[model samples]
Target: MDNWEEVHEKWTSFQNLDPSLKKELDHLAGDKKKLEDAFYKELTFGTGGLRGVLGPGINRMNIYTVRKAVNGLAQYLKENTVNVYDRGVAISYDSRYMSQEFALETAKVLGAYGIRSYVFDELHPTPALSFAVRNLGTAAGVMITASHNPPEYNGFKVYNEDGGQITPAEASEIITFIQQTENELTVPYLERSELDNKELLNWIGEEIDNAYLEELAQISRLDDDGIKREKDLPIVFTPLHGTALELVTKGLRQLNFTNVDVVKEQAAPDPEFSTVDSPNPEEHQAFTMAIEEGKKSNADVLIGTDPDADRLGVAAKDDAGKYRVLTGNQLGSLLLDYILSHSDKAILTNGRLIKTIVTSELGRKIAAKYGVETIDTLTGFKFIGEKIRQFDATGETFVFGYEESYGYLISSFARDKDAVQAAILACEMAYYWNKQGKTLHDALHDLFEKHGFYLEGMSSLTLKGKEGSEKIAAIMESIRKEPLAEIAGLKVLEVEDYLSGERTFPENGSVEKIKLPNENVVKYKLDNDCWVCLRPSGTEPKIKCYFGVCSSSNQESVETLESLKTEMENVMNQV
Candidate 1:
């Protein structure tokens, strides 16, 4: 079948395998299925780069695998990038297990090629790495993180000179060079001593951090009149045992929020993520510790960030005095409304609000209220970053960009989703509303009252390992084969099959081309302006179903969302 056995033999017999890794390989001696799954193929490296379980196999995220990927990037940059050595790559890592090791190994691989790399001394946010690329005028950047994945998982993401994730075309070229790397263990790299002697590996920290924070301070300040509005407002933050503690705390303090508190349990970087079952901020479970801290301190608001701090989750006390976690869409809507209502007219002129296709329509309506046009990109924040670059070229202001996955971008300083900037601004907004005797919950209600209650949610089925991958493919294929006409009595007006790059309108029997890049996704524009979309996760082994509904009242939106979700489940179950 494949060369898995051949690959396995090479890995096991390698002379200089890490001793711990060798032991792990030895433990797999009598396990055929585990071996097959681990060595069936090299880890998939797409636009998102490499992500997989941590272990010794070629398909896992071990030192050799990391080296192989870095070597491929080295080869690609040497060929395609201008001033390859002079315009070095910026590298940063998160709090995941072996993340620092992977970050150092990345520098060493590039060092072997005589390519310079500026490495952060400690763990940094993904967006900071993106900012460092442009700040240092580097040819590319690398961030070693799995985002919100489980403890045993780790990943590497690539960025272009524009400080955005590598575009699809660029990814295709890098994948070609990566495939050219035949032997993982044989890939050459400079040792730490060699790296130091060559002066190719450089350490970077505080200066870049200050630069990033200073840029954020320029925009995160909402009230400039030196007005006193609960400046000591109690705020609770938790990094969820990730990398956000230093930057986020400094950011809040910079905003003059003196009473900010950190959940002591999640204040330190934890590889095992001992505090929460899942490290993702989007989940309510991740807020347990932060909410507990909020209750003890009578905090006005709570903010929780994922491991890498690219995503932010928020909660605020409602009239009932209990904290309620805000959905990504709800928080996004609040941010949009606050920015538009407070910003000067000239800055708002020709402003653009960019959102992913799956984001709630409520933000669109909010932007329209301010006369700002809302544009939809694909699901990834990179697409939004690309739009920011495009708009800059055309002399339009990049107002704000966000997605439904708890990631938001305020300014163009950091091209990727920036939770640091968002946290500062969100805390300021919360404190400002608090002075008026209202919580963020009240601000959200004011938005809902004006722009109809928009409820959006996602459900994913986790299918792990190779079998899960196959099942995800089969499910998508089945949906394409037999398109749906209705879901729970709701009529489907149009079906968008992104794989085919075509949109079919069932009512008119017509088709149109979708302008976005090709992805394996399907969407339905149903009657009553409701919509549903399904796509296999690019970075995780899951198929996600996104549902959205807008109604005159909160109760109506909730009921319709439940109906839509149940009907979609029934439809997929049939498939």
Candidate 2:
């Protein structure tokens, strides 16, 4: 068990491995480094669930690992969920390699434990899966997708009954059970025939889609007059070869937006994502085809969604009439402003805006204009979802929520971020601004003029395999052990170490508690209204740094952010 040879032998002994996988095992025999990397450790299960490259071995996202994870989830349900058989799991997958197979694997594993499962007949967006969990009154949900990752990657995301990603405590307990019951090569998975015979497997399609779409439509605030006037507003949308093609387009049509154009080349669900370098909508590169179509169609705005369709990206015409992609922060700010402008004053006063700590402060400034308070969570939408759940008793209205990575939620109907919701919002907001002789870019400039300038940027450094993991650990440890006093010549006013749940103000030598859960994140607040945060990405083999700055002008904000980024890179490199 201590060596790669032992792990390889055990895997080779598995009689039921697919023929292709067996060939793969045999093919890997000569590559000791590959074998060691494949078997050195199992994929870690955390708040994001399991994510890794697609291949054989416990460290990957093959059937055996999926089964083991599902079995652990089944055990967790049996022990915790009341009426477990009645309140089962709703399962869906995206158009990634082996995603459908992994979804089936999950259902089969749950079926083996006498738990019923509603599996999607085909691929669906991650937000739809979250909606299905609540719509079906299920105990939990499972989505087989790697979000916007590359083709080689896949993941399994777990959701609680409320349709949000499982909290840290639930992940911890499920991970414990997975470690105890996981014999990856021997994990049990029921046959489709047996599961069907037991009535434990059900295929869900249009009924759930209809319900989800209905819920999504409820979040729309476009009046008929506005829709009628702006129905012909030129708009271009792309699904980026993932699951949002139907929902995003259909949602816009339902809102009477007749001039919507779909990017024909990237419309279908292609597992390899052959159209773009990466399926991430956050990157302008993903919109290469969309932007081309936009110009040809004289589109006023362009929108695109990631593979799983949980994130959205938007492009708008700048002052010079050139199409420019909006950053996640800018989009979120525009959407917030639009939603609030359309709301009644009383509702705006009572509403609360939720955003990740790393998101731009521009959202806070916009929300403050309406007398709405902004709440900060850790860098995940689930924490924002948790806040929405808490609002039932707190009497605070959930206005809008977004993270800096293009994940957004406009309503509580779906717990996770909904690109379908964002698409309609962005288009309608564009149309609304267009009606007033302005564009999103114009609106952003107006905001900057009124509320001062704020900018946010992020970068990630990739390191692969075991060595990379060690390097990430060393970097974090070094930063924690010896904190920085300044960055980019700006004095560090405070250091918030989320891992220790402490916020220390260097000026006053006072330490206060951070009321959120402990996480391996370090944030430095500068003397100026700027800050930087560092954390390892939960789903990828990379470390991410977030920078935010505010000043009287855009030039100052941009220059300061670049300076901070350079200093951050220098510090990370030394670490």
Candidate 3:
């Protein structure tokens, strides 16, 4: 069906649509661009799951779309899962506008299909939901969060029975079911009272939180004594007005960290995320309040977790007494070093550091120094989680996994990035180093000095709506048509085209199949371990470019990173 036809069907035929959505439809009636933007295409049920701006229309994230997705999940589970009713599904949501409503709708839709749902009593972090799936022994899990996206956005993430994000194969099957549910309004759904009467809905609370925190405590390098030793370490944290406040604070307390501070203004769950332009911890704007709190408290370090608490951001005071936000690569590398350096290397015979292709090589280099191997997956943490599952079955140890987008996973138990776990370890690292009269800044500097300065940078071009998406597609195709031979004077020795499913060398023209699953990404490998990557964001309407370089001095790495980023942006713009 054409886009306008879908809009007309929703606008004229779907009478039972929510009043607010109906109002939005009326509001957009006069604007063809807005109408087309909202109806041009269905919001993709990607490998992770559904995510989009919350509004009216078939394409927006609303009850109809949520129900359709859930109903499809129900259908998929009914066919694939054994004893599906008894196995059940876990449901969770962060503190976003309509998050609870969407989660409730998910349970209702599943209930109509006779699928049991274990939902949280209140908002919780994404990691807890990942843990809940395994802890409850459910068939699957759904996390309703847009992660670090702007206020207008909300999302749904599906996790497998293994407690990790759904694999590509599983997602593909579920997506087929979703696409077959043509009209969103036709998806089977039950009311809340009906769900309760059917005994298909269960509410989860601190039991899940406690279990998740205990796992974090176990994987931590610190014991009670170590936590006590570092209890007096001054740290500031902000949840960016999302669902992380209670659990992260409780986790810190459980570890006996005494001097932890929460940024008062951003501590509560504010769906609007009113304080910041975008709630992404990767951006400096999100750290404004945390920085102020850090300065006033004379904090040794500052940490901020995005809404849903999957990704973490850290800042530490430099010599000028100003807080410098560490890039995801820098912090991830620091954490990787901290975890490996303080460990018993004898137990690491099968240990591996799993990271995404876009992640910094500093980790690979760091792992080499400690005699550990690093595995590079595609850009998503889901890929990292897949590696963990694979290694587990293969009798290998999953040491640590991270992405440069401020996501990290310490223990494989959760199967996704756990900001709470990373926060605990960051606090511990700060305390341990602080006792030796070093701040996190000093520790980071020490790493750079010991293992050459490694710098990384990311740039995003946001172009919303259908036209923007087409342009993004155009840019990606252009990059493929004319591959970069060099980045900032460094020769591009190899190209890893995930979409093409091949890794080719420029000099020899040798080709090898990429073992990782196909994704719409192309990476250029340069001499001196420098490289540039170009890919469209999976969850947002933006093109992302990542640049990484390693050098002996900070200036060299900084200069190289700037040059690489500048040159790549020029390439992208030309496209």
Candidate 4:
């Protein structure tokens, strides 16, 4: 036993832990830098799995690292499927703090390997556990959320069976069977009433929330005289206290949507969200109680979701009625111009629009003004749910997807970003811009009077532990050895660099190949239809950056997005 005497014999084998994790392993026993930051490594299930800060060592989130990451997803589904216990493992959880005892210790560590386990008896949203892992034909899926982190964080994620998240070569072969389960205190688990009496632990609630609110009412593009003229569109929502309060208020009262209000102190199920300081619905101070109940119910949209509702935040109200907030690239360019002015040009000639190369090229110029085609992943809505499962046999049709960090997806049912289908398409795009008398802030100022003033901005930077992971890998290796041919002065004419999968161009030294999936991200473009990226936030410690601009007005795209955010914080303060 070497490694610090095997972390003090695994912190004295927690002696039957859970007395508040044995008083946090006796307050980090002799505090060798807080027990080498909770046991120097071990919680690394990277490509979206196992988040931290819950407690008792080996880098937190306990129940023995959630049963060694559900026994490395039940030994990567008993060595890659063939009915590994009948292709099961759904599970879900979100109110945080030990999310239902780490989802029944991840269904008793996938019922001690004979697998099968549905779980979710309550607290749902993380896109209803990605539509309950493609409605339980599951070979994967687990989501004890850290979705919108805080309340001392918690996470686990993993998903696949095409319900997205869990790829990066199945999280590098399930972190090589969760680092060969050396000992999460001698692993093996089972006994959620003996895995629910060998039905292998079932449960599931409201038959998966009424088939995930009937696929969130086919993400409403509204009809029936536009839901009877936006059936009293007041809207206000708030689930900021976690788990989209009973399916975004019963999926907007099952679409009849009568002036909905909610936010009664963040509507309940709150795992210490205690009225926001960071339940992150992409921060507008987490919509301070849904913009003070949207200025006392005059409301015209004020949504807020976070804490596992799968990120969504809005605000709306403009035309001097006040409110504000938009940006997640202006509600993904007003929900892709209200789903391309109510779709059907034969489905906009086989539409598409997935985003995230740090989103907001004004949603790839409003999906090139309806002629659709706009892909660009690597930031994770599970790479736009693995590009809608690689264009699901290529007939093309996924009309909406977003991520400027307010995360959205209209309807591919659920492959992640779905604040209950973006709160019913953001209250049917704010009642189709208040029945044209306008306001989603006047359809984002008429899409910046037809796409020119496309401004966007983001910045992050936080540096936390291990010299902030060696200064976020020395600021992405000093921006790949200094490559900014002009940022605030605007003229970098291309650079891509998704960790050198290549793009270059820089005034003629041509290069191209970035056909995705390499990720460490960086981009540039500039010179008019301006741009800028620079990744690192694959689930925060921060580096972000983002910014974009188009100009030809809106105060020269907000002064060239504040001079490319003050030259990206002076290039992250000179790395």
How does residue 4 of candidate 1 score in lDDT?
88
Worst lDDT 10-window in candidate 3: 3-12
**Candidate 3: regions farther than 4 A off:** 228-230
Q: Is candidate 1 or candidate 3 better by lDDT?
A: 1
lDDT to native, each model: 0.90, 0.90, 0.88, 0.81
User: Candidate 2: where are CA atoms >4 Å away?
Assistant: 227-230
Global CA lDDT of candidate 4, please?
A: 0.81
For residues 1-575, write the lDDT of model 1, one tens digit per residue.
Answer: 35889888988888898999999989999899999899998899978699999998988999988998999899999998899898899999999999999999999999999999999999999989999999999999999999999999999999999999988888999999888888889899989999899899899979999998888778754656543333788999999999988889887777777898999999999999998999998989999988888989999999999999999999999889999999999999989888888888788779999999899999999999898999989899989988898986798888899999999998888899999888988998897798789999998898889888889988888888899998889889989998989886689999999889999999889999999889999999887779999999999989999999888999988888999899887766666
TM-score of 3: 0.98
Residue-level lDDT for 81 in candidate 1: 88
Residue 357: error of model 1 in Å?
0.8
Error of 1 at 210 (Å): 1.3
Which lDDT tens digits does candidate 3 get at residues 19-60? Answer: 888888887777877877777778899999999999977778
Q: Which of the two, 3 or 4, has more TM-score?
A: 3
Tell me which of candidates 2 and 3 scores higher on lDDT. Answer: 2
Q: What is the TM-score of each candidate against the true structure?
A: 0.98, 0.98, 0.98, 0.36
- Residue 539 CA error for candidate 4 (Å)? 2.5
Displacement of residue 445 (Cα, Å) in model 1 is: 1.4
Task: Give each prediction's root-mean-square deviation over alpha carbons.
Answer: 1.3, 1.2, 1.4, 20.2
